[model samples]
Target chain A: MDVTLLSTGIANVASVSAALARLGVRAAPSVDPETCRTADAVVLPGVGSFAAGMAALNRHGLGTALKARIEEGRPTLAICLGLQLLSESSDESAGTPGLGVLPVQTVRLDGAPRLPHFGWNRIESAATEGLVQGGSAYFAHTYCLRPSGRLEEAGWRVATSVEGAPFVAAVERGAVVAAQFHPELSSTYGRDLITRWLERARAQSAVDTTQGATPCR
Target chain B: MSMTRIIPCLDVRDGRVVKGIKFQGLRDAGDPVERAAAYESQGADELCLLDVSATPEGRGSALETVAKVRAVLGIPLTVGGGVRTLQDAERLLCAGADKVAVNTAALARPGLLTEIRDQLGAQCTIVAIDAARTAADPSRFEVVVRGGRDRTGKDAIEWAKEAVEAGAGEILATSWDRDGTGEGYDLALLEALSQAAPVPIIASGGAKTPEHMAAALRAGASAVLAASIFHDAETTVAAVKSDLVRLGFDMRLVSAPMLPSVSENSPLPS
Candidate 1:
């Protein structure tokens, strides 16, 4: 499968691209929207602040391209800062406009233990979805994605949550999948998700080429 | 009412599976996916995979490992090491991990907990606090991160409450002063942490015996996790569960087919 790793000039883009390659995916770092559209899947891995990441995407004109690709039913994976950019906006750096792919907003974890939550965590699943095999994965972030509706129905929504409010950690709409955590950095289970995504992208590629239909719509 | 949990943690390095002594010399632990499955078979309540590496390049291997681990274990798996933003947590979850654990980052941005909790949901996020008692404050432990490389100087008890209020649904408090020592459970820290927060607490560090497990439970730990005991075959999952049951903790016994551990380089099972 042809997979384009969106190079927003974020940290560790090569890592993710390399992982996808192991899954038989033709991974390439693409800043051009046209190049992104040509691939079966797009992976956006970010490492900087939300505002800066968005600015980068905007500068490369990939923001509109990303939305268009998602609307077209192409699968996309957004990791770390990439995932935050999927939301409406965040207070982290201020004035950062998210892609608004999911109906959610970002905010600081008030009273949080510290600046960045760096360690392994457990994910308590509230429902059955492909994203959740069962337990938790690692996490690191001061801000999270808050979504209002059922994650599945919203097309764009948070995958998991803390307490009662759901954070848009991972979003899946048919073929479109994105997350707030760095799966490539997660360990074995995290790598599995990337492998599965490549498979999904391949499957979706077949459908996209044959039916010429937008699965997301 | 409280909830039941199972966790599986993997040793990581350069983004792959690695193990080592207490925050020091490290070694490989084979493929992460294989190790995770072994833990699941043993009925791990939850899983924590920590990247022992400090370099950014090595951190990349950690993300690759999570993507692999998430594919095999159908249970909750948390990923850590060098995470600094909400996007990190989201990416891990997207790759199939259920939650993200923050340490150094959370200490740097205390309000970040609330921000992440507010965005995700407090239940899905967790704060992994590594604490060590200081000579100046022998009675109090302080939160440390970077694999116990950096000290936050924040009081452990105070930080636990701050984490919960910030949206952390759970806390994995590891005692650095006692980690890998296996002398005994850090009951004083557990007791204090439990009192400070309403969320579930997983008592880590210095778990030496089944008796230590009981002591932790009595001290208000929601769960007890140990590496030496678990990895050395010193105790089996059934034995530990039995011990918990005998200690008055309710446990469900289930018998499922145990599958052979699959290699990381192998194709996924059907």
Candidate 2:
């Protein structure tokens, strides 16, 4: 499978690229909006401030390209800061607008004993069909989106996890998957999840090719 | 609650894992890459690669070691040992490290933490505070730096809070009084710092048994770091995690059936 490691100019793409390589699928790193849009699968990975992440993406015009790609139901996987960047705004970067592909906003992880919510945490998925499953994944973030029913009502499958309070861990609709955790650092569960996602991304891309239909209307 | 982390620390000198007593008498354990793979198979939540090399030339190979380990391991990798400037931390992060632990450098100039945080993010910056109990005041802890050779005269607990405010996301607090003692972690130190520090506290030094780890966690450490026990193969990360689970602590558990075999370089199990 052709995978594009969407470079946010901050995250360690080597980890995700290495994870894919372990799965015997080589990933090409790209900051180009065109490659990010047309790749068979694109993994948007970041590990930093929401404002900085959005600024970098917008600088390269990949933010608009990603919204277009996800709107077209093209295979996309966003991780950590990448997931937060899909929201409308964030407490981490107040007044800084995100891509707004999803109707959500990121807020600081309150009520938790710690701030960053670092380390491996368990993800509990209610949707049986979604790529997110009940497994542990690596997380390093200060801000997160609480489980908002509005996201689910917006036609997205949201998985919740508890760090301080229940927060959205993973979200998916069609071939687009977003997680507030780093699957690449999740070991076996992550490898399995990536492999499964790759399989689905391949199939969905194939079906979309034949259907000649746009996604997300 | 955030998951309890079992971190296996590698003190690498000249690209090889080394065993030492209180950071002295270094002896080779194995290749950093090989040791990382073993730790991964043992379910280590994260791997800490510390460059214990004293010479400038020796530090060069430490980055090479991190790159080699990153080639095989999928867990979170935190690299440290002699991060003197923001450039040092940046070099390590650019060399495939997920997190950079700074100690002496952060002490010398607290702004270094802010610089790393601003450029690389707070999650990437960790302050590894080596604290030795002050002899004059038994209740007070003094910060030690330059690989525990110099006394900073700064309060460890206060520094932890300041470091966090300065942009350190985590504190890897080690007790000089208990380092390499194997008597168990310094509970008082752990409790004081855990309560004082706003960020996650990684308890280090003097952990000998699985219960020692549990005791540290109970004392308030979000994660536990050990080198001698895991490096000497006295116990595996899996064993410690199993013990944590048996002690009524929830664990991620020994991974699924597909974790790559440590015996050889293998592709992801499909």
Candidate that would win on lDDT: 2
Sorted into a CAPRI-style docking class, model 1 comes out as incorrect
Quality of candidate 2's docking, in CAPRI categories? medium
Please give, for residues B1-270, the per-residue lDDT of candidate 2 as tens digits.
667999989888877777666666667777788778888888889999989888889878888887788888888999999899878877787677989999888887899999999988888999999998898998999998765778888999899988988989999999987887798998999999989888899999999999999999999999999988877767778888988999988777875433443453223222
Q: Write the per-residue lDDT of candidate 1 for residues A39-139, one digit (tens) a residue.
A: 67788877656777778888998898887887777778877677778778888867667888766677865543433444344454454657544344545
- Quote the lDDT for A153 in model 1: 67
Residue A125 lDDT in model 1?
49
- Residue B52 CA error for candidate 1 (Å)? 9.2
Q: For model 1, what is the C-alpha lDDT against the true structure? A: 0.67
Q: Write the per-residue lDDT of candidate 1 for residues B127-201, one digit (tens) a residue.
A: 988889876978889877677777778888898887787778789888888777878778999999888887668
Which residue ranges in model 2 land beyond 4 Å of their true spot? A207-217, B255-270
